[model samples]
Target chain A: MISPVKVWRNQKKIQKILGLYGIIVSWTKVHVPPVGFSSQAPYVIVVVKLESGKSYIAQLVDWSENSLKTGQKVKAVLRRTKNPGEEGVIPYGVKFKPV
Target chain B: MKISVLGAATTKFGELWSRSPRDLVMEAVNEALDDSKEISLQDIEAVYVGNMLSGTLGGQDHLGAFFAEELGLHVPAMKVEGACASGGLAIHAGVTAVSSGIYENVLVVGIEKMTDFKPEEVAEALMGAGSDPERDAGASFPSLYALMARVHMEKYGTTEEDMAAVAVKNHYHASLNSHAQFTFPVTMEKVMESPVVSSPLKLLDCSPISDGAAAVILSSKIKKTGRNIFIVGSAVATDSLGLAERDDLTTIYAAKEAARKAYKMSGVGPNEIDVAEVHDCFTIAEIIAMEDLGFFGKGEAARAVRLGQTRLGGRPVINTSGGLKACGHPVGATGVKQVVEIYRQLKGIAGKKQVKGAKLGLTHNVGGSGATAVVNILKG
Candidate 1:
């Protein structure tokens, strides 16, 4: 998932930066029980691998059903996900097929 | 017996530049004294002061003693605390003292100076008032309200938009109130877009931490030739302090019971309330208060807000002085400050936010959700 700073700083600029890296990702939904439904939609919890070879929990966003698998490579994008007055999202669930 | 508010005064509702807690108290106390026609410091037989967090917020103990010395009043001065409802409770104490014939005129002041502490420390200190010190070791006040917001969404189908709409409406009203802490208007989009402090609750939905004071002089003696707002009814009730012990999480039981008693005493119903100043430490709390106070039907308060039915021109305008959401909730001063707004509206002194033909008004001050509650009815 992209960072909130990236999503908020420059949506178009972040998108262009990710495009150069050939990364594609989309939103998806996940459900963890006990608490009821939320209008904010489901979230995708992600882990990212970096140059240090350490992985961290990536950002999550609401997504639809049955779009992801166990192991997938994707790039993040900065986009407006919810209310206009809010900051843009760095939905980790947003993933694209890695070339 | 009706209690007349001969005079009312409040210090600015935010952090002070060069004032101590006692200074804030004196500022408002002096104003109230100035507003009174014939009342003097010597005429005040007793004194009641409300303070929420002197020990924790400002590291001061025996606060009443310090404040009384500043006023040069050797009269019996005592501090009354009911969490956030301290100010209202102090007023209630003064009213009882005068109406019981023990004293003809009584002075009540609510004061808190909180900017002395860092924001995080203040939050921790305020949260301590709500629970057994051991139980609240891990949770903050926002987390408690967040849990309630979750339950409200599940039980009553309340939406985040509905919550944001409350912030927008209150901010708009606050813009008209010159004394409000946040005098800027906010939009639903703006509320929703603001960074989320807790799930389903954002920065806009929460009242800011502040430092201020308020005072009201209640007299049992009806003025021979002057005008004043009378307190026809005042009722306070207590509920289980712990959230886990309550029957429900979405509603405040003590507030409902106290409101019932207040209405019974005032001989007025929900429809007769021209204006109200309710505790809205969080946007969800106000939504819950509308239903609990019987201003709207259960589960419909959010809709009432979205439809603009609680605005200035609506059937019953709520929080015209910006409420705790926009008006700074200075802990001790909040309850009396609420009464001050009601008095201003009933007397037609609320400049841009006054409701037309407002003969009756009410103020609801609840402490730590449902633990302690005070409901007062006012009439001109």
Candidate 2:
């Protein structure tokens, strides 16, 4: 359950990283997830080193097995980070997709 | 450097459903006092409690006052939190207090009650140690370690079998430990066949959520007796909260730095450590800990572990108490338990798991994914 104000504030920061290009540094498939994330079980998370020389960790969305390898090119995108329960704020954050 | 551990004790580690946190604390603290013989509850001038989840899971805080009152002691007390390193940090606090001449004798206890909640809830609570970004990305502890394991494998040709060897050896050591969570040995096949919690990390590779407590009595009043165990070195270091910010994924910089400081402070290097108890929250963690602690070179710990170089009868026997893998990881209790195990080894009272002629020992404790590390060197 995310605070609506915190989610709103984070969205402003998320906008900066959106659409940035990066290369994968490392990756893993999460078979077990924490609360508010069970709906996205078995998701791939990657460490990406952006072209701007910054590093980020985000879910590898719209990916294939081939896209999970190290050094794979990726682009950051906005996605729903968690499933907010009824009357809760739906938090959105940066995720990566194969370039 | 003047701090000495007068006594140490730990309750059995496992899913202790019947015991409350107060129950566990009483047992561990009383037993520790009994072990000291010369030191009683009245001798304790201050108290430090190390814990992680009492507020989030149990809705209770102010553990220092809570435990102090529980033991009927009137003294200055406070709680210490550094994720999983809470216990080690508390021990460090005790050392600092004694070294600063603020108090002669102090009691430090680390405890947690994790079995009271569901697995998912516990997993979520544990993530409080990590960054909010990691939580948003749904990266559990296993997934975070799995990310590191993949990098180590790609760079060093480390295999799952190599990681499984750690579980096998630790479980074998656990079989000799009466207080361990899983008092039975596990085979490589069993570990290899266990369900994958995260790719390349199986169920057996991860330490179980447990409930227990460990306590130690630190004193500057060293008796004239020849068998006083001293804390030769104590140090801690911190790094980025998330793995993404780290310059290297294969090594924990905090552990390396903390070990370096501790070793330098103790005037003892890796080769001189007769026995050790390292944080093995995950199989990959133990492997990386060996490298970070300088027990083995980068990309060499996996093979050395597979070759039985750290096993009992081997040089500097590691995790003789079965480690977190089989000893049960009660988060806050783990770091303190590591110290207790080493204390027993140095006292030559570890029973079946004792390292023969063990004179010096080390304990390593880590919080989150390489975020914080605490290292302590002990000599008998």
| DockQ each | 0.02, 0.85
DockQ for candidate 1, C-alpha atoms:
0.02
Question: Clash pairs of candidate 2?
Answer: none
Over B34-58, each residue of candidate 1 has an lDDT whose tens digit, in order, gives: 8776677778778888988898766
What TM-score does chain A reach in every model?
0.35, 0.95
| Cα lDDT tens digits for candidate 2, A12-58 | 87888998999999898888888888888889999999998989998
Query: A1-99, model 1: which lDDT tens digit per residue?
Result: 235664445444334334222211111122211111133333343323322333222233333333343234444444333332234442222222232
What lDDT tens digits, residue by residue, belong to model 2 across residues B196-248? 89887999999999999999999998855547898999999999999999999
> Model 2, which residues run further than 4 Å from truth?
B224-226
Each model's lDDT: 0.74, 0.93
Evaluated at residue B144, the lDDT of candidate 2 is: 89
Candidate 1 ranges beyond 4 A from true positions = A1-99, B133-137
Best by DockQ: 2
